[model samples]
Target: MTRFSGFRVLKEALTGHNGWAPLWRNPAPKPAYDFVIIGGGGHGLATAYTLAKTFGQANVAVLEKGWIGGGNVGRNTTIIRSNYLLPGNQPFYELSMKLWENLEQDTNFNSMVSQRGIINLIHSDAQRDAYRRRGNAMMLSGAGARLLDVDQLRQMVPFLNYDNARFPIRGALMQSRAGTARHDGVAWGYARGADSRGVDIIQNCEVTGFRVEGGKVQGVETTRGFIGAGKVGVAVAGHSSQVMAKAGLRLPIESHALQAFVSEGLKPTIPGVITFGAGHFYVSQSDKGGLVFGGDIDGYNSYAQRGNLPVVEDVAEGGMALMPMIGRARLLRSWGGIVDMSMDGSPIIDRTPIDGLYFNGGWNYGGFKATPAAGHVFAHLLATDTPHETATAFRFDRFNRGYVIDEKGVGATPNLH
Candidate 1:
């Protein structure tokens, strides 16, 4: 089970603001680009930036229907860690964490990247065994991680419930290198860097359909007009399936709501990212003294960002469990975003059946933290037309081949993992 980070309650006490806001400016289009990236979220922006930085400028475009950073880029709880339980995903995520190490220097965007330590709590013997295996895998991969028993857990999280009602702590998987970062800064930094490199950032341009030729995708047809591309790539998380269907393709992913909330501002109480594996809960505190967090998704498909009440109640209940002092904290606000639930918990980053087309999606809840890593690996794929060995298992046909990398072995609810 995941442990509650105990930061959400502190966010409610904040008076003046929600965390990140959107910045949208209408601009004219350039004649052409080397690559056209659809979806202006963190991954899309990062992809464009990486392409320009590596492949050189004058051929990249990021098209967004709404605005950059307004999608899941800003909507996620912003947890950045590589506590995955598999081989392919674990190393890939560790690489992403390495990029995040110098993102501020790379993009000159003060992302406020924090490495205040993150812990995954275990509630059952089964979970302890899983943590043991995962920890050993990390050690084998040369990543630093440890499995802490109940005694060590108490030292790490003194406020936690040692003896509990619903569940009790047995042990925890701790990765000292894991943490969170500012989401908007990450997007804006990449945007500014990519823009300086002459990449076009197009907002309010919705791709209505794809323009294909002899089984090759030539360009895209948008609400504004027809624009041609040498190749087309879709990185839209929430609307990935919708965009792919325009070309007669339907991914195994379904859009679902993942809601998050903040408490009124309190003193910087909660320190780092926390997850309650046994329950639907997680929390973290931002530098601004606001606790930022959410729990498991709503478990239903919906485009609406407004979530139901039960999730909020569940989150608050979990928060109170970890930090009883937060019982009186006022819930300031809550919002949700559409998550692209992949068939397996892992992401899908590979070539599809459509020629001259590609994908950088199936993120589920892994978007914000994996931004730089996604951009780098995806750019490598785009430029070389080859899968980064780390992402080879995340191909589209894995589902059909029965080569599923089900990290949590989450059966039907792909988003829950």
Candidate 2:
């Protein structure tokens, strides 16, 4: 691994920039390992990185069906924040925020973590109070938050439709430390970090079935081969059901397609991440001047990574309602990623009924933001066989115990979540 720094950049520039090495290796999987992570996306790669770097687990491998960064890890809008109102979600996300803050230094890779800020606009008085409460919850969790009045919001984002006849923007819940990171860079960084610590990152290696004997997972059958492992961790988002079914375990998760859009490059418009108070639309300006945005999931169960027109039109309406000026901007391209919408909208990171199998999925729309903490906590569980303190509420048996962490209060309906 080549260490990247200003001196290296200068040296490379002087030497025709040919001294750079690949960020991560394309390693072949071993026949057996201490641990195997079934996915190569951000969460899986981060899990491998944490297991090797943090937990001192050297015999680890990350098996990805496709290439790295080909999943939701690179498909998200790249917003990172911790402004939840639920006890189960607030602290976990706050931990992720702190991890994001120092991720570049920790990984020795430039993930392009920009802590610009994020503002969730408040529309009605009730919404204002709700945002205030949410902001208070964020503060209580040691995540920064502030309540900004309409005037303050106007000063920050004057392009918004402040006084619309329907759904007026009264205020906003602001998180100063919240922002975005480069999606693909995050995956590459984690992959590199994990590989440097002797974790094999095997791409194009699909897990076909679980090798369970006597009710405990011995390993997994993959396209590459039947790789043996002491423990197997499943972090395949959206495909949780299909993957778990191979092991005779069913999850309380539904797959839904969530679309994200990027507009034609424009001037520096969106100051930071901003969400409409009345709708699910959220927009942020990328470093390359493109306005990246997204909205609610497609409101239907789907395994496809493409969405329908109704969602596009609905998201456009939300965007226009928030900032009418963007109506003139042309949409450059759009894509969708399948999300594992859990019954209660919160993620699950817990040990399964099977002895050597662990589960981590049902992230809904929060997967990208929760990558670091999810990986750390999931790795903690895998290495120590105990749940992280902040993630104690994300139990697999919570639904059966009638203790669902319904963060959005949308009840048991996965589509609504």
C-alpha lDDT (0 to 100) for residue 286 of candidate 2: 95
Q: In order, what is each prediction's RMSD in angstroms?
A: 7.1, 0.8
CA displacement after TM-score superposition, residue 406 of candidate 2 (Å) = 0.9
Model 2: pairs clashing at backbone N, Cα or C within 3 Å: none
Q: Which candidate has the top score in TM-score?
A: 2
lDDT, candidate 2, 343-400, per-residue tens: 9999999999889999999999889999999999999999999999999999988998
lDDT to native, each model: 0.81, 0.92
- What global local distance difference test value does model 1 have? 0.81
The TM-score between candidate 2 and the true structure equals 0.99
Backbone clashes for every candidate come to: 18, 0
